[model samples]
Target chain A: MTGRHDPYVRLLRWYPKAWRDANGAVWVDTLREQSEAEGWSRPSRGEAVAAVVNGLGTRLDARAAAQLALGGIAVRAAVEVTMQIASPGGISVQDPALNGLVWIFLSAFAIPVFGGLVALSRSYGVLSPRRALAVLAAGAVGICLFAAAMWASAYGFQLADDNPALARVASAAIPLGAAALAIGATAGWLVVDGMLSRTRLRRLPRAALSLVAGVVLAGLAGYATMMTLGWVTVGVTVVGLSMRSLGGWSSVEPRVVVRSRLSLVRTLAGISAAISMLGIGYAVTAPAWSPLAENPTTAVVHAILVLLVGALPLVVALGLLAPRPRLHVWGPVALVLVAMAATFYGYTDAPLSTRIDSSVPIGSLALGLSLAWWVTARLATSRGDRLMAGIAITLACVVWHLAALLPVAVFVLPLVAGVLAVRGTLARREPIQAVRTAPVTDR
Target chain B: MATPLTPSAFWILTVLASGRRHGYDILSQTRTASDGRVSLKVATLYAALDRLETDGAIRADGDEIVDGRARRYYVLTDAGASRLEYEATAMAHAAKAAQRHLATRPALLTLAPVIR
Candidate 1:
C-alpha cells in the first residue's frame, strides 16, 4: 500500500490545488487499491499522461478565455488611441515622425494585453465576471488619474518650452497619450480581471516581486532621461506581470475533456487567430491609408514591421493555451517584459516615411472580419460549417474593399456572435425527443 | 424530460443503482460492470460526478474513515434512478426496432434464391 501510494501521490500534483484538496487522497487511495489488486506497483504511462493533460487543459481553458476577452478589448482601445495619434491638430501640418513615436508608445499596450491574457490563463482556471468588472472600474479610475497627471505635466512643460516646435509635438502627444491611456486602462484592466478569474493565489515570492519592482523602477528612471517611456503601456505591463505571478496553479488528466471549459478555449483561439489575421491585413494595406509613406518601398517595409510587432505578442499569448513545453507557458511573459522595456525606451523613432497612417483606421475591416468569423463559427451548425464560414469571411476581408464599413462591423460582428453562441448552445442541447428518434443507422 | 444522460453519467448512476458507494467503490464496481471495456480516470470521474451531483441525479450519502483516510460516498437519487430506467427502456426499444428491421434483410436474401 505504501509503495503504490508513493507513485500516485507524485501523479496527484498534476491536478489543481482545490481539486486535490477535495479528492486527492481519495484518488491516491483508489490508485493504490487498484494497483495492489492488479499486482502492479505503479501507474501506467497512459494514466499519467491522461492525468497531466486533463489537469493542464482545465487550467488553460480558463486562462485562454480571459486572454481572448482582453485581446478584443485591447484592440478596440488601440483603434481609438491610434486614431488620436494620427489625427491632425488644427491647421498645423503635424510631423509624421512624432505621430510614429506616439503610435509606438501606445502600441506597447499589446504587450500588457498579451501578457495579461497568457499569465492569468496559466495561473488561473476561471473568470468571475463580477470581480473583473469591479477591477476594470477601479483600473479605469486609476487611468483617469494617470491621464490627469500627464495633462498637468504636459501643461507645465508647455509653460517653460524653449523650442516652440518641440513644445507643439509634446502638447499634441500629451492629450492623445492621456486619452489613449485612459481608454486603454479602463479596457485593459477589465481584460486583466476577466483573465485572472478566481484562481487561488499563492503568496508572491519576495524575490519575484522585488525583481518586477526593480525592472519597473529602472524603466521609470530611463524614461526621465530618454522620454521614451510609453507610460500607459508600462503601467499596463507592470499590472500584467504582477497578475501572472499572482495565482495558485494546477495539473493533468487528458488535458481537455470538460466541454463547458473547452468551448471558451475554442472561442478564444478562434478569435485570437482572427485578430492576428486582421493585424496582418492592417500591415498589408498601409500604403493605401498612411500619409507619411511617400513611396511604395517605405510603405511596404512599414507594413511588414507593423504586422511583426502586432502579431508577436499575440503569437506568444495564444501559445499559452496549450499547456506544454513550459517554454510556451512562461515565454509570453518574458516577451511582454521585453516589449515593455522596448516601449519605455521609445523605439518607434523611424523617419516619417517608415510610420503607418493609423489615423484612417484601415485595420477595422480586418477586425470586423475576424469578429464576424469568431461569432459565426461558434454558432455554425457543425465544426465543418464553422470552418468553411471562417475561410469565406477571411477571404472576403482580404479581397473586398470593405474598410469603410469597419465601425459598424466591429459592433455588429461581436454582438451577433454573442447572440449566436448563446442561442446555438441552447438550441443544440434540445432534448432527444426534439431530435430524430429513428433507428440508429450504420452510416 | 431532461436530456439523456451521457455515457459516463449513465454508468455512474448505474453503479449507484445498487446502493450507496464511495468514490473508489464506484470506480471499481463500474470497471467490473463494464467487463473491462471502460476505465474512468480520476479527473473524468470527478467531472462526471460533479455534473451529476449538480443536476440532482446523485447525492452525497455519507463519508467514512478508512486507514485514516476519508472516503466520500454517493448514491443515485430518485431522479437518477428514473433517468436510468427511462434510458434503459429507450435503448431496449431501439434495439428491438433495429432487430426487426434487420430481420427483413436475411428474408430478402432467402427470397432471391427462391425466385431464381
Candidate 2:
C-alpha cells in the first residue's frame, strides 16, 4: 500500500483532498494512459511534475472565482467611498464650463452606446431596419447639432472678446463639420444596409460585430475629440492607437457563442455607465481647477486624479456585478458607499494626515489587483494559449495601473506572475495525479 | 417543385436567389414583391441575412466593385431551399384544413371567420 502511494501519491497531495477522494483514480488512470502512449518508460518526472501542477491549478481556479467575489466587494467599498467624497453638493452641471465638459464626455460615451443599441435591436428583431436607420440618422443629427453648439459657444466667447476673426472662422467651419457628420451618418446607414443585403457582414454574430465596430468607432471618436481639445498630442494618439491595436490582436480568437442578446445589452450598459461616470467626474473636477489653480498642491491633484479615473473602474465593475446571481443586491449598495466615502475625503480641505487615514488606497489597490488577477487567471486557464497571451497583456495592463503608486511592484509582480501563468499553461502542468485501480464495490 | 413559403422569408430568399444585390436592391425587391407592404431597411436586411446564413440557408457568393466600394453578393443554398419547401408545405396543409372547415359555414360567416 505504501509503495502504491510513492511518487504518484505525493503528486496527489497537490489536489484538494475532497476532489482527490472523488476523482483521484480516474485522473491517475488518464495520466498513466497518456504517459504510456507518449512512450515514456514509466511516468516520466516531467509528466509527474505536470500532473501535480495541473491538479493544483484546478484548485486555484476554484479559489480564484471565490476570491474575485470577495475582491469585488473590497473594490466596491473603495469606489463607494470615492463617489461619496466627489458628490459633495450632489451632481449638477449648471456652470457653462462644466456643462461643456459634460457634453464632451457624453458625446464620447453616447456614440458607442447608441451605435451598439441600434445594432443589437436590429439583430434581436426588436427593431425594424427602417427604425434602425432612423435611429442612426437621428443620432448623427444630434451629434452634428452638439458639435454646432460647441462651435457656437466658442463663437460667443470670441464675440465677447471682440475677436470677430476667430468667430468668423468658426462660423465658416461649423457647416462643414455638420455636413461631414451628415455624410458620415448617411454612409453608416448605407454601409449597414449594404452589408445586410449582400450578406457578407451578416456571416458574423450581430453582437460580436457590433461590439467590434462600437469599440473601434468609440476609440476613434475619443481620440479625435482629445486631439481637437489639445488634450493628447499626435505622438500620444499614435502610441494609444498602437497599444489598442496590439490589445485587439491579443484578444482576437474564437469565443463561446453567447447566444443571449441580453448579455450584449449588459455589456453595452456597462460601457454606458463607465462613460457617464467619466462625464460626471469631468463635471465635478474641471471647476476645481479654476478655483484652486493658484495654490494647487500635489495632494489635491493626486486626490482629484484618483477620484476621476477611479470612478470609471468602480462604476463599470458594479454595473457588471449588479446583475450577477449572488452579488446583485449588496454589490451596488456597498459600491455606492465606498464611492461616497472616497469622494468625501477627496473634496474636504482636511489635512493630508486625516485624509490619508480616511482614504483606503492600499486596500483599493489590493482589491483592484486581485480582481484583475482573477479575471486574467480565469482567461489564462480556460482559454488555452490565446488566453495565456492575454494573461501577459493583462499583466502589462496591471503594471500600468500600478505604476502610479508602487512602480517597482508593478514591474516585478506582473512579470513574475505572467511568467508563471505562461509556463503553467504552456507546460500543461497539474499539481496532482490520482492512481487508477480496479473499482471497489461498497457493502 | 419546392413547397410554398412564408410571405417574409419567401420574398427575402426570392430576392437574393434572383441575383446578387446591395441593400437598396433588396429593399426595392422586397417592397415590389410585397406590393409596398414591406419596406426593408439596411439594418433589418443585414439582421435577416445573418440569421439565414447561421441557419445554412444562404452564403455570400462574391463581391463586386460599386461606387469604389465592394458590394457583397449572396446565394441561397440547398438547405435554405429545403426549409422554404417545408414551410410552404406546412402552410398549404394549414390552408387546406381551414378551407375544408369553412366549407360548411354560412356565406356571410365565411368572410367573417378568416383563418389565422
Candidate 3:
C-alpha cells in the first residue's frame, strides 16, 4: 500500500529535511509496524506532536544558537554607544583635535538602535498594526515627558534670579521626574517582556531550553542579579551543554567545538557590555554632576541617567532584543495597548533643551519639520534607497545637533521611528544583519 | 565526562545490549525493560535512537523486511556499551549512598509509635 494512507508518513513533513532524508523511510516503517500491530489507524495527537516538536528541536543546531547570541549582543551594545554620543563630555576627555573631526563625521546620531526597534516591531508585528503603534506612542510620550522635564529644569535655572523659589522647586523635581519617567518606561517594557517570555517558554528549542529560560527570567528580575544570571549563565550554559552534550557526546556532537565558539562570542559580548556600562555611567553622570554639585537639577538628572545606563540592557534585552514568538503574539498587542493608555506624547522633542525651547523658536520648528520629513521619507522610499536615505537623514540630523539642537537627538530620533512604525507607514523590515550595534548623547 | 543516560536512553541501550533489535522491537522492549513506566512515543523513541547512533553509542547492524515492513536492526556500539556500564555503575553507587543515608536516619520519629 502507498504510504499516503499512513498519517505518520505524511507527518514526516514536520521533521527537518536533513533528518527526514536520513531517517524518514525507516522511521515511517517503524511507525507503520507499531501502529498495525496495535490495530490503530493512526498515531495519536500527542505522538504526532512529539515528533514535530523534536523535529523542530533538531533545527536549533550550534550555528542558529550562535546567531541568536549575536542578535542579543547587537541590541545591548547599540543602546550604550547611542547614549554615549548624546552625553559627551560626561567624561570631559579633552581630545581637542579629535573633537572637531568627531563632530565633523557628523554621524554620531543613535538612529540604528531605533532602526532596530522599528525593525523588530514591523517585521514581527504579530500584534495588530493599530495596537503596536499605540505602544510606540506610549514610549514616545514618556520620552516627551522626559524632554519636558529637562526643558523645565534648564529654563527654570536660567530665570532663577527672577523666581528663586520656583527655580529651586523645578530643579529639585528634575531627578524625580526623570526617575518617574524611567520607572514608567520600565514598567511598560516589563509588561511586554512578560508576554514575550510566555511565548518563548512555549516554543523553546531543546538545545537552548535552559539558557533561554535564564534569559527570560533574568529580564524580569533585578538588573544586578540579571547581569550575573543573564551574562554569566549564557556562558556557563553554553559550556555546560557542551560538557554534557548528551551521552557526554564524544566526536560527532561537537559540543566541545561549540563551547569554544560560544565562549568567544560570550567574551566579546562581555567586553562590549562592560565598556557600555562604564561609558554610560561616567558620561551620563557627568552631565548631571556639572561641577556645580549645588545644582539640584543636575544632581537629579545625573542620578537617573546613571541608573538607566546601568539598568538599560535589562529593559532592552527583553523588550527590544528578545526573539519574537512565531505563534501567539500578545507582546505587540499588550505594548500598544499600554501605548494607548499612556497616549500623551502630543508634543515633539522641542522642550528638551534651552537651545530649542528657550532661545530658538525657529530652530525648534525646523527640528520638528525635519523629523517629520525623515519619518515621511522612510515611508515613501524603497528598500535600498530607504537605507541610503536613512544614512543621509541621520547625517543631516547629526548636523542639526551640531547646529544647536543637540539634547533632543538622544531618544527623540528613535521616538520618531517608533511613531513611524506604529502608524504602520514605516518601511518594511530590512534584512538588518546589522549584528553591528550604539550612540546615546549625554550632553 | 561519562554522563548518565536518560531513562529512555538507558532502557533503549539496555534492550540493544541484549541483542540487535529493530525500531519497533526496541520501542516495545524498552517499555518492558522500564516496567511500562517509561513508555516512549514512536517519534521520541526514534529521536533517541538517532541521537544514540550519532553519539556513536549505537549503530544499525542490519536491515530486512518482515510482512512488508522494514526492520532496521540496531546494536549497541562499544561506546554505547561502555556508557551504559558507566551509568549503571553510577546508579549503583548512588543507590548505595542513599541506602546508607537512610540507615543513618535519626530516631526522632521513634517518638511516634509507627503512625500510618
Candidate 4:
C-alpha cells in the first residue's frame, strides 16, 4: 500500500516551489486525514487531477519571468552578433561592412530591454501608463546606447573606404526602429491599461470564440500559403491554430476562484514577442548589398516588400489585440490598402525595370485582413460574436484568393465587409461592465 | 463587495468559526456539521484554505506533529467573522420572504368543500 503522503506529494509537485515550501506540510497532512476518514490509503484520482490542473493555472514567478526574458534577449543578441561577424568576405571592406555591423549592434539593444519589460509585465499584470511610459523611456535609452555604440565605432575605428551613404542610412534606421518600438509599446500599454480598468467578461460564448478562432487560424494558414510557404505549411498551420482555438474554447470558463492560466499565457506572450523580434531583425537585415548599393529606390522598395512578407503577420496580430486609434480604426487601414494597391501597380509597371514579386504585396494584404478578423474575435464575449468575425475572415480570404482568377477589384468586398463588421460590433449597446475581481488569493 | 462564498469555502469557514482547527479537524467537522451534505476532497479543501488565508479571512494559528506528520491549524479572522455574519443575515432575510409568501397563499382556491 502506498503511504498517504506519497500521492499528495506527487500532486503538490505541480505548484511553484515557493508555494509548496509555505503550505506543503499542511496540505499533505490534510490529504492524509481526509483519505483516512474516507477509508482510503491513497489520494483519490479526481483530487489528484484537480491539484495538477490547479498547479498549471498558477501565475509564473517573477524570478522565472526575469530569467526567461533575460535569457531570450541574450540568445537574440548572440545570434545577431554572430550573423554580422560571419557575413560574406568578412569585415575587411570597412565601409559597408562596418556600417552593417553598427546597425546590427544598435538593433541588438532591443532584445534584452524588451525581455526585461516582458518580465516586469509578467510580475505585474497590465502595466500602468506611468510604468509603461517608463518602459518606453528605457527602450529609448537602450536604442540611444545602440546608436552611440555605432557612432563610436564609426568615429573611433579607421576603416578603409568609409561610405557616407551607408552611414547616413544606418543613423536614420536606428532612430526609426526605436521610434517604432516606443510607439508600439506605448500603444500596447494603453490598451492593456484600458482592458484592465474595464470590467472583464466572465463568460464568453463558446461558439463565437471558436468561430473567431477559426477565422484567425484560417487567415494565418492562408497567409503562410500566400507569403512564405507552400500548401503543406498552410495545412499544418491551420490545423495547429484550430486545435489551439478549440482547446481554449472548450476549457472551463475563467473562474472567480482563480485566474490560473494567466501566468502560462504571459510566459507564452513573452516568448512570442521574442520570436517576432527575431523576424523583425531578419527583415531589417535581408536587403542584398548589390541591389541596395546600385539603386536606393529599389532597395527601399525591396526592404518594404520583405517586411510586408516577413513581419506584417505578427504586427497585424499585435495591432488587432491592442487598443484601437480614435480615427475609427479604419482610416489608417484604408490608407494602407491604398498604399498596397499603389505598390502592386509599381510591381507590375516597374518604372525602373526592376522585377517585383507580385505575391508579396497581395499576400501581406490578405494575411493582414485575416489577422484583423482574428483580432476582432477578441471582442466576442457573447455567443455569436466570434462566429461573425470568423465568417468575415474566411470570406475575406476567399475573396483575396479569387483575385488570382478574377479581377483584383473583388478584394475590396472583403475589406468593406470587415470594416462593416467591426463597425457593427462598435455600434452595439454597451456591454455590461464586468466587476473588477479581487487579486487571486491562492495559486 | 465580497461575493457569496462557494459551498465548499462556506463549509470550511463554518467549521473554523468555533475555534482554531487543524486541517483534519475542520474536514471532519464540516462532514458532521452539514450532516454529510458536504464532503470536500483534500485538494479542494486546501485550495480553498489557501485562498481564505490570502484573503485575510483566516490565519494559520500553529503547527504540531502527530505520527511524524505535521498538522497546521487555522483560525478565522475578524473580517471573516463579519462576512459570515453578513451572509447569514442575507440568507435569513431570503428565508423569511419565502415563508411570508407561503403563509399568505390561498391554498383552497378551487376546492369543492371543506374537510370537516
Every model's DockQ: 0.11, 0.02, 0.28, 0.21
Report the lDDT tens digits of candidate 2 across residue range A132-193.
55555565555555555564554444454556565664565456455545544443444344
lDDT of 4: 0.49
The CAPRI classification for model 2 reads as: incorrect
Docking class of 1: incorrect
lDDT of 3 by residue, A117-167 (tens): 322332232222222334344433443444345445545554566778767
> RMSDs, each prediction?
26.1, 24.5, 21.5, 24.9
Question: Which candidate ranks first by lDDT, i.e. highest?
Answer: 4
For residues A228-318, write the lDDT of model 1, one tens digit per residue: 2233233333333332343312222122223443355346434544544554455457568878655665554444344334333333333
lDDT accuracy of residue A150 in candidate 3: 45
TM for every model, in the order presented, reads: 0.36, 0.30, 0.37, 0.37
The global C-alpha lDDT for each of the candidates, from Candidate 1 onward, is 0.48, 0.44, 0.47, 0.49
Better of 1 and 3 by DockQ: 3
Could you give candidate 3's per-residue lDDT for residues B1-116 as a string of tens digits?
56446688899999999998999998899888888998888888887777678679999887787888767889999999999998888789989999999889987688578763
Q: What local lDDT score does residue A348 receive in model 3, on the 0 to 100 scale? A: 28
What's the interface RMS deviation of candidate 4?
7.1
Which digits, one per residue and each the tens of the lDDT, describe model 2 over residues B4-70?
3335667788787667765446656888887988754333354466557655788877656554433
